[model samples]
Target: MWSAHHRRTAILGWLVFVVLATVVGGATGTVTASDDEMGTGDSARATKILDDAGIDEPASELVMVGAKSPDGWRDAAADLSRALDRTGRVTALKEPLPSKDGKEALLRFQIKGKSDDAADQVQPVLDAVDRAKDAGAEHGVTVHQFGDASSEKHLNDLLADDLKKAEFTAVPLALGILLVAFGAVVAALLPVGLALTACVAAFGLLSLASHQLHLFETTFSVMFLMGLAVGVDYCLFYLRRERDERAAGHDAETALRIAAATSGRAVLVSGLTVMVAMAGMFLSGLLLFKGFAIATILVVCVAMLGSVTVLPALLAWLGDRIDAGRIPFLNRRSRKGVHASGSVAGSLLKPVLAKPAFFAVAATALLLALAAPALGMKTEQLGLEKQFGSDAPLSVSFREITAEFPGGPEPALVVAKADDIRSAPARDALRELTRRAGKGAELTVHARQNVAEIAVPLPGSGTGAEAKKALAELRADVRDVRAGTGSAHGPALTAYVGGDLAESEDFTDQLGEGIVPVFLFIAAVTFLLMLVSFRSVVVAVTSIALNLLSVGAAYGVMTAVFQHGWGASLIGSEKVGAIENWMPLFVLVVLFGLSMDYHVFVVSRIREARDRGLGNADAIREGITRTAGAVTGAAVIMVAVFAVFGMLSMQDMQQMGVGLGVAVLLDATVVRMVLLPSLMSLLGERNWHTPRYLRWLPQVSHDEPAPAARPASPTWQHV
Candidate 1:
């Protein structure tokens, strides 16, 4: 309550912190993860060898020229090459290579810089291609371009647009939900304001953090979404509790204290639990997850801090004015409280508590039925066509190019390194690799270096099953050729197959291996945290089980809708046969963490009711009735935000949005309202049973203190 007592200092201090962090973070700028650091297994080794040798691959781009006649296509392609050469942004331009059908030709070149800088430098090359399109207009010729640089540029642009859309949509949608929940404009705005500031502050902190641990391109968007969701939820919980206390006839000052003692403590515990679950991502050992863990944990911590300190301070300062601009009907209804006889929450809880075992069994069955589809869930690294949607220009170009040429756009690279790679044995090994690679492999040797690259054409679109099969065979060929063709003299050559396909395969395998450990880590830590917080073994176990159920159901829903193509057209999603490999673990941890917010908040309220001499049944009913409105509002807000993301064009965002939205909806409604109460009712007093061994653990009370028993000092209590 020191913050409440010094409201000006607290508010000003928070503002200054946000501004400084943003300024400092912006000044430092964010460092992005390099492909070398992102690669795994052999791909990583290959990249490392090249990186160590200071051999950076220039960006490879291709211009595909199509026409009714071969003459027209070749002429158009030549014009494109000359036009590209005139741009002075390209080098090593190659002659037009004819497709098998001879109706199209491909002009290949490298952007004249490090591949890392290609996305930025490829704009001129794209413009040159655009200009050459007109030169081929006569003869019905058409030019399409696709490559590493174009794909990167397109992804970046798409991400930027998604971020903007999220900003404009999520904020207003959250604010609208809060408006309905609070009924007062001022009261509703408070949570939105707090959440936005927390996001701003976390953004700066994440930028600073990125220097030590470089982040993925989408990290900021993820952070923003998480920050808004949790920040708003925490503040909503705190604010609603304060308002409830005030309406219960406590003076403003006393209401603030009680709210802090009860909801503030719950927020703290809930935040800690969320942070622990997010930490599970670190066990995945992927750079992508590491950045996500850092970003989410940072945002939750900032939101938690703001909830306990700045939120309470703001509530204190506002006093009666917090209810300004209240809608007449909603204000009266809000003041009428949640325990009314006609309340929907009460009616729902009545049946739940009446037949605890029956409701519990029914709810569990329902969730299990939803989860059944997950048993057959298949995972793969989605090709760009599926990821960005087939309608995307890049995907369209990819399809056309692959149809015309045996190898689509990207080629598999076989990198070999050793002392004297120019030796006769190395030459023989290279020749064997080319022979095995069949028809379309080209070799390039560095001037004085020991490394050589054989670019082998990949069949089908570079991201499809055909490409993966070809890559696997090529890698096996590398292994076999590596064993037999090495010189007897010094050291044998070390070869690795590396390219986009190789990276995807390695990444998929890495995630597949890491999933079990990550799941166990999250579940174990969550169980321990819930046990310590609730001081009950049953409570902790149930918490984990319920969260897992909800997560499982989410998986099933994603699989049914996305993988099985059941009603996918309704959501504008493509029916890719598999989910993204990174998605399962990422969704698992994120859902587990986010689901804890409702679990902790609702359970804390129930425990508080029970501690006040209510029987298990009555406490479940009472606790659920009192907290249901807020929890439901928070859930709606979360689902709305997630749904906005679901509407995005990117398959990853769409899946995340639907998966998270469905999980949150289920967690808040069926799981919390029906299953949690029914199970606790069945357990009765045993729900609070704690063994003698757990007596040594610290006791954290979330109950509101009685008027006379309340501490006098305006200080926040430590749990």
Candidate 2:
């Protein structure tokens, strides 16, 4: 058990963690020189394409070529160039790069930074392009631009704009919800303060890591916000329990110690669950996922540390000050002078226990109904161009361009190589394949070669079945042609498909395959831990079932809101076919951590009650009642914080935020508050039964000297 001295020691430990984190974080903040040749398949393919096409000049040496035949276009391009010149982020290409075809006019620009950063520099060039649009229209010329800078700029601007709104909405709303739930200024502020500290630490660490590692900027706000939610949520549970114990006549130190031994241990277990679940991302092998895993793990670890150390320390230091502003409007005070038996929480549990079997069955059935839609869930790649508000200028223009000329901006490339570059048979086969591919109304082969690239324009509906089928047919045809040739000299050929759809499909496949193993791993670990801690088979099984229900119900809610487009407009993202591919796995990992927190709290309390000689049924009802209000309060605070993310413009953040928020809310309420207690009540004394072989196992009892049996009275008061 954690004593007052131990609490003080823990506080000192946190101070040490903070000091070390700051120094280590700062030391890693500097960007390091990276080898330009360290690139992936896509990068290599892009390089090969450019080199083969004789456009292999370094991006820094490239410049934008602009024409002034159209009205206002020249002035716009000039103005954008001026802006870029001032920022010095990139060198504006003053001269137009020569076109591969003499018939076409091109505007070429070069960026001095990494390929990723090049997209960040595209905004000014895009603005110039927009300005020149009207001029081009007058002269029957259209401006089309593509480069790393342009894409980066577009994504950066889009994320920045959306994150601005999220900041404005999520923080205030989350705070207000916490304030209402806790009904005390200091108590409400406590979780928020801890969450902010954790998030700030996480952000600094992530940013520093990004200098050396490939960290996605879009996931930063999400990680920060969710970290805040989880931190606050964990603190809320322990603080509420501490307050309850104090009200039950225990001294401050005793109550704090009891809460730590019970809720604190739960916090540790839950945090570990979340950390391990997140660590599963390491299996993905993708740099983005690895970065996300690292960032999430760091945040979870920091939040857990805060929950156990800083939170307890703050409670000890604040003492009575934590209850300074007991808002009469929000406080759920007892109506009569009659003290509710069993820890001031029996009244809430009594109703559910009245019809335990019915409530249990109904809750389970409802969760299953909600989970039904998840079976058919499909994933699609969400791009900034698709997620922007309908009124956004870029979105509108992009839509129009795609509609007018299928795949005008984004085209799928067909890459192939042949041993006999000039062979007539290879030429005939290529032409035949092109002809067959062009027959599909969904796509048009714009360009081709015997040992070269073919630009296949995709349909306007980017992810329609027709597009998928067309790509399939193209692949099949290419395969058939290559198979007929007998010699190794018949052009060693391989096709590399690159596009938003392809990337999305790849991501989705990876996510699906990864989910089962990850969930099983989490469940197995949780089961082993619970079994070890409680030494009860019934307890372990019940915990797993309850956690799954919580996750299921949360998934249902997410399906309705995100997949069904219930509040798409308010969230600033369009319903783009399906959720992001990795969202489910990410949610599972995160929710496992969060849901386990409540499980530990409830189970620990039940064990405490049982140790006092309470019957199994009585112990469950009493434990649930004592913990319900606190768990519910924590869930609400977490939900509110996550809901703030729903207001973000970025589709990825919106999906993750909504999914995590709903999961925590459902897990706390439907699963923990209702289903868990009812099922335990139905099981009666059998709920705590352990196998005969487990009798020799070590027991994890927090209380000393089990209480003696008392008369069976209607009222069972702790004191």
Tens-digit lDDT track of model 1 for 451-507? 988998888777777888899999999999889855564457789999888988999
TM-score of 1: 0.96
In terms of lDDT, the poorest run of 10 residues in model 1 is: 710-719
Candidate 2's residue-wise lDDT over 85-144, tens digit each? 655555545643333332233333466655545565555555655665665566554555
Every model's Cα RMSD, please? 2.7, 7.5
Provide the lDDT at 684 for model 2.
79
Score each candidate by Cα lDDT.
0.87, 0.65
**Total clashes, candidate 2?**
16
Off by over 4 Å in 1: 134-139, 333-342, 484-489, 708-719
Model 1, position 348: C-alpha lDDT score: 90
